[model samples]
Target: MAEQNKHLYYIDELSDYKISDGYPDVRGWDVKDIDNRVIGKVDNLLVNKEAERVVYLDVEVDKSIIDAKYDPYGRPVQTEVREFVNKDGENHIIIPIGLVDLNEDSNYVYTDIIDHRTFSETKRYRKGGNINRAYENQVLGSYQRRRTGSADSRDLDVFKDEIRLREIIREEIRRYHHDIDKDVTYGTLETHDASRPRVDDDVLIEDEIELSQRRSNDEVYDDDNFYKRREFDDKRFKKRTPGL
Candidate 1:
């Protein structure tokens, strides 16, 4: 039987799932603060299996964010998770997925709601450490303080506001799609053979050179089958030339 309540999993750990079509896969994209100062790289995504969507970003912070002076202004009151100092090699942190925006042109994952100071003060964990509910709430409380300024931010039911969270995510994705589509241009492929356009001479020819007719029409049929290609047949693609 499968675990019914297993909530989160790293995107990579699931072989059957993948990022949705047309949505940006933010892994490896640079993360920036509100002012666009680079803070980290998005190392991975944490998906909620039950929700069938991404819920958090696993960011591997840059040295500046890791080394910045810690501020206690928005510290969580929870005794179990009040430590803001990152242990040696504990430079990974999680940001709620709904809080970030995408820069398709620059390929950046950024948040306008959170600042660099708040990030520095949030608790960090090992790269693949177990992230429990208490630690997640602690980090959320630290960020919530910047927006609400509530003294008891830690006790508030931030994640329970599911409607608000979904709205934020939808709005960000809509805006990002709009931005990227603004500069996109389209063109048509001029193919001589409509039935086999994939291997048409106009498409296959490259480097301002046409393929010689002597090369064989068998190439057209073989070209469509990846395993029957020259690379697999010749066995030279994986190896260096003998003399060189």
Candidate 2:
């Protein structure tokens, strides 16, 4: 989730910096793809206070398929979602700060680094030891591998890749169980809309910043939604040598 730098806080929470002269708070901006197709709306930003930089734009992505001519950004170009056969569920993707494109409009953020599949498959963001350094390395490293192909990356087979992904998520669940505070945690196996905001021109918006949003239910964990812990037999999930 934006590579947990030691310094992370809402803009107003920290007094170390001020909004630079020309930039706008991009919290509720529309995130679009290269073709100017609507992908999702910006929810909040993860700021790396140490760097005085924005590290990520949390976006809620639309995954339902529609009938259109190569609308790669997942917008229903021609027909509404109901007009076409169903596709898939939605996701809240963390668009890396480096990947965003800022234009003069100041009301939108753009990115062409990926498509719907990548955004949907990537794990949702949560704070804590839930995100491991190695996993983050593998995740961020995947962008490059996704570009050039993956002969040197984990070097794992397709089956192993699935296993690795599951393990990564498993570790996160375990860590959430241990943490005193978890901004977001696994609530149910059901398709859940992670707490994200929506705003448009019609509504008068507040310029407030939210570090994280919790799912509505008070109970963050449900045994029915979780699986029995199993051993991965690999040392990487246990040891610190890295390279899973």
On TM-score, the leading prediction is: 1
lDDT of 2 by residue, 1-244 (tens): 3433233444554567665544466767877754567777776655554446555565665443122222223223466553222233324445556555655335677655544444434444432222233333333433332322422333334335655855665455446443633432344333334563222212211111110111211233222221111111112111122352
The lDDT of each candidate is: 0.61, 0.42
Model 1 misplaced regions, further than 4 Å: 1-6, 71-84, 147-244
Model 2: C-alpha RMSD to truth? Answer: 18.7
Candidate 2 runs further than 4 Å off: 1-7, 63-91, 126-139, 145-244
TM-score of each: 0.55, 0.40
Candidate 2 lDDT: 0.42
**Candidate 2 pairs with clashing backbones:** none
